[model samples]
Target: MLKIISNQDFDTFAQNAKDAPRKRSHHNLHEQLDAGVQRLFISTEPETYMRPHRHSEEHKWELFLVLKGQLDLLIFDDEGNVTERHSLSPETNRAIEIPPGTWHGYACMQSGTVGLEIKEGAYIPTPQEDFAPWSPAEGEDGANDYRDWMSTAQPNTK
Candidate 1:
């Protein structure tokens, strides 16, 4: 069977990062995709920041196709160090494969930046993600704390 989801239908799946801790993963398209693959729609503001964390179970990778705006894909090591960064813009359609156990987070460089995320999954109850110790847990500190860490934290030598 062949299926086609229009822009309207896909937008319904998009989710907000701010509501994630409340267990609201915003506009996600997990059910629409086939097994072993889940699609998610992510939209964020400039001040929005996802705390540093890692998914160790699945080979967690994502293809972020920017629908609009800009973002910074910040990757970290086990010690919560900023290892690499990617500045993503809507100028191109691209995908970044993030390996499992790579601590990562994102900062919205511009408001209303929407991304289409595709990844492998068979959802589990517990978080396959391990949050970095040095990073503040969501709601514990303001977004500024995360930004500060990124600017000041030493890079991983490994």
Candidate 2:
């Protein structure tokens, strides 16, 4: 069956995300497809902490489109230095494609934010080597500061 996404779906997703322990939820769009490509609707609250990591496999590019609310796509260097940031919203550029092996993360700028994500996948665990060593892991004491910096940081380079 073809999946349909209406405004109601987003509203429900947003509510679920808020209720989730981690302040995040996902409505999988390709549940039945189950192929190389994975697609889904992600709902995230402002408290969501997306750890800075990368898909080291060259073919694993990921794309994101903001459907509601605001998000910041943060690109970092190997040393956890901010290299670029995209403030994504319906009013601004709402889409981004992160290249494979590029250290990146996202921070929700508004509560109940929703985004569509598309990427190649085989449901494998992300390797430790792909996680940014310079960045704090999720739940670490410094993770909040890192997430905050990603949310408000300005682009330092093109």
Question: Cα miss at 135, model 1 (Å)?
Answer: 0.5
Candidate 1 displacement at residue 20 in angstroms: 10
Per-residue alpha-carbon lDDT of candidate 2 for residues 1-158, written as tens digits (9 for 90 to 100): 67789999999999999999888998987765546888989999989889889999989999999989998888888877788888898999889999999999899999979999999976567788998898888888998887777778776631
* Cα deviation of 59, candidate 1, in Å: 3.2
Tens-digit per-residue lDDT, 56-147, candidate 1: 77566556666666767778767766788777776743557777777877766665567777767754432624777777766675557775
Q: Which residue pairs clash in candidate 2?
A: none
RMSD of 2: 2.1
lDDT of 1 at 14: 35
Q: Per-candidate TM vs. native? A: 0.71, 0.93
List, in order, the clash count of every candidate structure: 6, 0
What are the RMSDs of all candidates, in order? Answer: 4.4, 2.1
